[model samples]
Target: MVELLTARGCDVIATVGDGDGLLAAVATHAPDVAVVDIRMPPTHTDEGIRAAIQLRAAHPGVGVLVFSQHAEPAWAARLLAGEASGIGYLLKERVSATADFIEALHRVAAGGVALDPEIVSRMFNTGSRPLDRLTERERVVLDLMAQGHSNRSIAELLVISERAVEKHAASIFTKFDLPPTAADNRRVKAVVAYLQESKP
Candidate 1:
């Protein structure tokens, strides 16, 4: 998998065996993204998921892509807490297609978030809080922002001005208690906060 990713133009920064190694690699290399298995050495009981969460908390700039044999909704909820950008949780079975996997990597590397459809369906079915406070337009903006879209790109997609996009972003930051700053920094903080609040 690492070779494939490298062959497809991705820079393979480092590879680790266990969750601790994964976290260390993330801290040391500080790569743009991380791909972690759901199970890692030393208990192999959701260690990767835990490490992924810790990585997000410690290094918000690094995107995380978690692969698991099972659709662990609890793990998904944990990862989804605080922030959504630069984060992904996927089933190992879905990675068979090279193109799809590569696309997912690109999406995450670019600061776009992705979640397995199965996981989304499960999360919705498990009875979560209703996202009714946000308007339709706000939701659209949030999704694009989570996908790492710039104000210009968002404005273009929404047929609005960059200033309008900025206003919407400001509203989101206020609502989420995220500091309004440079886009990248704000995104990381917002995502971390979003994930933190996702828990019951």
Candidate 2:
């Protein structure tokens, strides 16, 4: 599959046998995107999905496309949490059609989000929280925070001052009912919550 993708003009930077290998590839190559099998070897019970989450946390610029045989909405929720940029989760069957698969890959690479239709439908069956309390800018900042961006980076991206970013983050925490805590610890908790509720 890697050879075929490269042959068709897509740059296949690395291929690995398992989730650990996928993490190592991200650390070494730092590719623009990752196309991973959700069922990787060595106790393949959502290891790929976990690895994708870790990768997103560590290197938000690197896109990830997870391919699975089943429509697991929990995994999708985890991946979509926080920041939704450059992420995709699709069934393995999608790869059978070259054009559709390649288009999905390109979409994620270009920083657009994509999820399989089947997965999307399944997510609706799961209970989700109401995120309507957050304003659009707050949501954007939250996503960036989940991607492991610092306040300064977020401020620069949003063209706001660092102090303003801090205020917005505090407001987000208040709206979410998150208690006061150390900044780093609070950030981690926020990301976890975001992932847990980010399904549909």
Candidate 3:
């Protein structure tokens, strides 16, 4: 890919073999976009996407484009994470279409999304999104809640008001279909739902 990009007049900053190396290169080079493969050294599981998520959080300006050998709806969901700006996910096969791949790279660098057709089709399939209903903020709140943080603690961590955190929590419960119940702990149930469905 680096060779292809360089040949096409795209300045390839650096290439790394592992996720850690990728992070280091991104931090040092600060390229407009980073082309990542879904599989990497040590595990070859989902390290690339995980690193991409961290990269986005750390360097919000950089775009990410992930490539996978097979269709992975779960990884796509994690990669998007309720936001699509400056993100791209394409199958390995898509790289063969040089024009399309280059176009996808350019699109992501410009804060636009470029999703492969198959990935888009699978993502929209019925019952695929067990947690897609949660808004981005609500998902973050729930993740903190799952870590055993109280509303006050979550508010402090997020630098938001306790009332706002409560509201987000309530929305999460509603979206999880956990209605008010005295006997059942809705918060615990919501966290459980998050734990079960949020897994890749």
Alpha-carbon TM-score of each model against the true structure: 0.66, 0.63, 0.63
In candidate 3, what are the lDDT values of residues 1-200, reduced to their tens digit?
77889888899889899889888999999999999998998899988989998888888889899999987767876776634567788899988899889988997898766767675345334343545887778867866654345799899999999999999999888888888876545655664444345346
Residue 139 of candidate 3: its Cα lDDT? Answer: 68
Q: How many clashes show up per model? A: 11, 0, 0
- Which residue pairs in candidate 2 collide? none
State the lDDT of candidate 1 residue by residue for 1-200, as single tens digits: 88788788999989899888988888889898899998888888888888999999999888899999886666776887756678887889878878878888888877777666565445334433332445667657866765456789999999999999888877767766666555556754544454444455
State, as a TM-score between 0 and 1, how close model 3 is to the true structure.
Answer: 0.63
Candidate with best TM-score: 1
TM-score of decoy 2? 0.63
lDDT of 2: 0.76
Off by over 4 Å in 3: 127-200
Top-scoring candidate (lDDT): 3
Off by over 4 Å in 1: 127-200
Deviating ranges (above 4 Å) for candidate 2:
125-200
Pick out the ten consecutive residues of candidate 3 with the lowest summed lDDT.
120-129
Give, for candidate 1, the lowest lDDT window spanning 10 residues.
123-132
